[model samples]
Target: MGDTEPRLDRGEALAATGVGCFLWVPATGQLILDPVGRDALDLLPGEYRGLAEDLRPKILRDDWTLLSGLSAALRGGLKDAYSAYFRVALHDGRSRWTHVRGNVVRDGSDGVTRVVGVVRDATLDLSPSSLRPPADEDSDHLHTLGEAAIALARAMSVREVGAVLGDELCLRRLGVKAMSLAVLEQGRLRLVRSVLSLDDAEPPQKSRLADSWPLNDVVRSARPLFFTSVPDFLDRYPRLAPHQHGFHATAAAFLPLVEQGQPLGAMGMFYENTNSFSLADHTLMTAWSRAVARALHRVTMLDRSREIAAGLQNAMLPRRIPETPGGRITVRYRTARQGVRVGGDWYDAVTLPDGGVGVAIGDVQGHDTEAAALMGQLRVAMTAYAAEGHPCEWVLAKASAFLAELGADRFATCQYLRIALATGAVHAANAGHPLPLLRRTDGTVDRLELAGGPPLGLPADWDLTPYSPTSARLDPGETLLLYSDGLVERPGEDIDRGLARLSAAFSAGPADLEELADHLLDTLTPGPHAEDDAALLMLRRDAA
Candidate 1:
């Protein structure tokens, strides 16, 4: 009772000062409201006993979804502060925009007992020109954070989580032009991911924590340090100034990445132009670090998980193209960088018992471990079916049924090719996959159009409607290109543009099968990680 008196008095003090004070008790799952708290939420004083009972009705209907999540975040069990903003429906047929800022209070066992926070009017702050920016930006930020959480939750490895961080936090969205992420692995600092302009300067010969000073110091002190200007940084760490040559960063900040007070890593963000960070900017960066640290810790453990997954996938994927009399069978596979997933893309080439070469390229739906596993199973299934001397159409039809029975939930697109090594005859079937290209002896490229069938795993039942394979003739010195959609498909773009790019690449590509494979792969992969995994398999008939 004595403790309750001071809390009530503090609430009165908050109301007297034009701010509202709120106390959320997890035991009852209720918010105790003071006079200003009621006014801030557009409620009558003493009209509500607890938040859960009276709050939902008062909240604007369209904003209920935001409110529900915000309630969790505001009471969000985090070691850091939680904040949210939303509009409340008023009695006078009006709405009030309010911002709630608070921290969760937990008992000795780390169980949240209560949440204490402040509330204030913040409608004007929602404008972009306002000091606080708009709630839309806040909403986007929250949405990205939610996505990061989801990515980490289902991540196959730490690298997948790292990919999420790079996608979310890279670039200057948060005034970070460059970022370096590193963690202590077995008493050695292992660089997780670094996006910086180091120019020709080599990496530090040693990778021990003691080798990097300010970074190591922050990890030890458990605090963030910032340098507002390049000269300021150079002046403080004179011994480290010489290494700055060609590494011209104007401003820098370092944060000790931690999880529940345990040191996990150290992260640094840099700016190219001279600048100073505002207090608000510092606060936001700190919050981002806390979130990133949790994700990165898991990435550190994913080394073996990724290795095993990669080994399994690599084993399932073809190692080399089989020798064929028609010409040479060349293939290339590139997984997306940053480890989004091992990928569901697979390519295989095998010599048939009938003196024909069977080449298959497929992309299983999804970008996770399950997708990779399913991709392996389906690839093996296709190889086995094709080996049994089945027609192209039969292989796909049987595969569709096989995956359905194998409990495959994701869909996949595949292309199968049977090339008669002696006659240069091509029989191809596309299972809702991309078209194959035929590069002529005259340097002209055309699509080998085929009747498309359903992808693997669909209808929750089965859709192996009998479909016929297509036929095309591969003349001497002519090439047939089989590729996965990742080579041509991108978001917000037409597939034709990618096809045209492929055509242009083939026209200008080397006549040699091996060089052609590398040339095409290098031309399309614009970033370190292709937007998705890309597979290229090219075959040409021998003129001799």
Candidate 2:
């Protein structure tokens, strides 16, 4: 539309109709309204000359949703023109019906970026015999609520929940200027997340619940608090007068998050120019706080549960890797990242009486407590058998038989290493386990091709063959790597591919055994969210 087109027709056809003109720029969120439009919205002449978001507190949540999505519909090519009927909160605490109609402005590239609209008082148009808003006008708010719920539900920790709530895109969609969340912990408030700030001084992360702050007051009284302007805030809390100069917000809302009559925490929202908050604003904010409280509680419990599971799993692994005087030993055990259940992967290293080191890495059949229990027992048996100076093959056989005798109806894959540090000799035994890799001093890598027996705990009739030891020599400055399948397993891909990747990583890894250990785990493991647990052991024969 031309600049003079709407003005000319508007002046001629609607001069006496009590209508007003507005031009909205989607890019900057600027909404310019003439004198009549200001009156129709019940706003003073100088009250709102900034962004459209500054009027959110005066509009109901559902109505705000309609107003915000109006330009979006035109930009998406869904419509060339739009019309909406919504209620605006009047200064006297009454809702007045308002009507707005707009047409999108497209540039030379046919891209819509601006909207030209006219607004008028629509209270009389909402009569029983008059036009009504579309039935789907309220659906937008419900959709917004549903999306937030889904994101909160998927959060695995309190930090993650905070991230979801503080997301910039989410805040933009809701027209929120700044947001802060704090939870009550043992009579104190602990800040969880803070997004966007209009204050020069940051709020303390932890504060006593009895502190003289709006958020603290809401938590104590279990009610919402609203400040219509900066002066309102200063008047209500005179003790904070000295800090008023640092606060740039024009309006603020602090809502208590209570569930089942129990107070959880509080949420604070700050706005630039919102003068008043309507009842609809109160209702919507209360509902949102309830959702946040629930999500926070759930994730807190999950994080604690995971910590407990991890503690138990750690208790079952070796407390220390006995010193290898003639070599270096580095080991790492990582639990599964997806769930609270403990996994069965474990590693053990013990200094032999004859100055050698007994190292073993294994994984049991399942990922539950039962599997973990069986792993502890099997690990002890293998350590005892190897410490007794038994051969590598004998240790595997005894451990396998011990697992079967437990009658747990489970199996385990294990690789045992008896290293003579002085001679750099490694005798490895395999029981249906991935072969150990030897990183030669020359930077080449090779697998110890040992014959594998059936996994431990199989019936005698089902056992294919006895475990066999593979003898390999590790030269000075060379390292031996033993790890569970999780270190080299990717979903829906061949094991060979993962193994190949591991080989390339190990060969090009750092020279220091300790750094090499970290390099292999960082390069080979999928991520912190790996589905399976992994235990890794690296032993390097130091040069004489």
Candidate 3:
């Protein structure tokens, strides 16, 4: 098609008919929707590229099924151009009767490659039965109700929402016999905890979609399925009748829950008697379903974020001990089993061009992926600030300002240490973190306590967490220990006790850097617990 000569006559013909041109590239699964076509269809401006299956929802479901598939149209018979008449269901509640004529572009062997088409609005020619007008009244009522539901759902915490969903006043308005929200988890609809009319009612015992073909089709089609009578539902699925043995329901409705066209789950409504759902009941449930879908989407995103955060942290953290011109640097990263969830502890080392090295360890405040994501941002800023050859105090100051400017609500405690290899001098800056421990050649250990500034992500523009750049000489056989509070602190124990334990562990450990790093934590605590993630960065100003 790309090599074919321009058809001036074809272009003029389309223009005369006031039609829009389109191209479907199967290789990329892209539908090039023209601006004119989009206007007629009432699509968003951002919905302009790489759209293939995205078109399915725009066309009426029945109409889409009637259209011949691309493969079938080009199967061994160079099929001539054909016309398709369908009703477009716009997302903004508009409808369009569309006429499309397309021809498959085939290779020399007649294998279909691309499809080119022209579309025209045929609303004037189509009768009411063929083309429905805009659903303004229903959409308006539904949208208004959906907004109210969202507002109510958002105001309540997840627990509160769960508690109120079935017995709550808002839900009672529907007068449903029973309601269950089942989210698709691990390819199954697991019933979320909620209040139900039947005190000990157990939802469909089957967890996976394979156990219920009716529910699977409902989710797959992203449509509502209602059974006004038992005979109708039972006759449709005799195999599933036995599975519904204990249920006492005369009517049922399953409204598929979808977000961004992806099926998330479904909400099931059961009634005690055979009944028709009034238009008002249907609209109200639609609103509730939307609200429920949003809540589920939020939770799903948080879980996804945790996985992403852990992966991102792992990727960015130092993989191998950095090569230094002087001292030995060993790092141990322990993730919290509970307190910080999966994304809390991180350590990094970046070498400077002047035979110097900068190291920092910090704990971001969070138990989930949000905290981990913030940790990444702050760590990257620290790395860049350090690598930029800034001094300890300057790096900390700039990093703090960067975090504050970035609008991170949570704060992090960081301890930055810069070692000058030529002089064996260590400069330190603290940001509300545990003080570093210093050990001399004579087996004496003492805290290099510094009055560090506030944690990062605070309104500390006036140098509130001012970096003073504490100076210390790193003589051969001496050590400096830096760690997150998790290494020392316990739930009920005092801060002083934790510090005392850390000092005792370092003093009792061997002179070897690696062994000492491992021994330090082992001596202080039995093993990593669920409270918090611990980080240890040890440096031996190696024997010169």
Clash count per candidate: 2, 0, 2
Range of the 10 consecutive residues with the lowest summed lDDT in candidate 1 = 127-136
Model 3 spans with C-alpha error above 4 angstroms: 1-312, 460-465
Q: What's the true lDDT of residue 153 in model 3?
A: 49
lDDT of 3 by residue, 1-544 (tens): 4798766787667666668878875433468867666665556767555566567667765344224433334321346466666668877665667777788764423222467887778766553232221223665455555544653444222322343344322332344555666667778766654223223343453476765555566776788898988899888777655555355777788888888877887777776644676676676668777777777676566556545545666765667768876678898866553322655567888898677888898887776677777777888889998998888888888887887887867788898988886678888888888888888887779888765677877776454636787887788778878888878766654577557656655775677888888766544444213356678887777677
Displacement of the residue 12 alpha carbon in candidate 1, Å? 68
* Residue 269, candidate 3: C-alpha displacement in angstroms: 44
CA lDDT, candidate 2, residue 68: 32
Off by over 4 Å in 1: 1-182, 190-206, 220-255, 267-315, 336-343, 365-371, 407-412, 451-465, 510-512, 522-525, 528-532
Each prediction's whole-model lDDT (CA): 0.69, 0.74, 0.67
Screening candidate 1 with a backbone cut-off below 3 angstroms (N, C-alpha, C), the clashing residue pairs are 158-299, 337-529
- What TM-score fits each model? 0.54, 0.69, 0.43
Q: Name the candidate, 1 or 3, with the larger lDDT value.
A: 1
- Give the candidates in order of lDDT, highest first: 2, 1, 3
Error of 3 at 186 (Å): 15
Error of 3 at 234 (Å): 50
Error of 2 at 374 (Å): 1.0
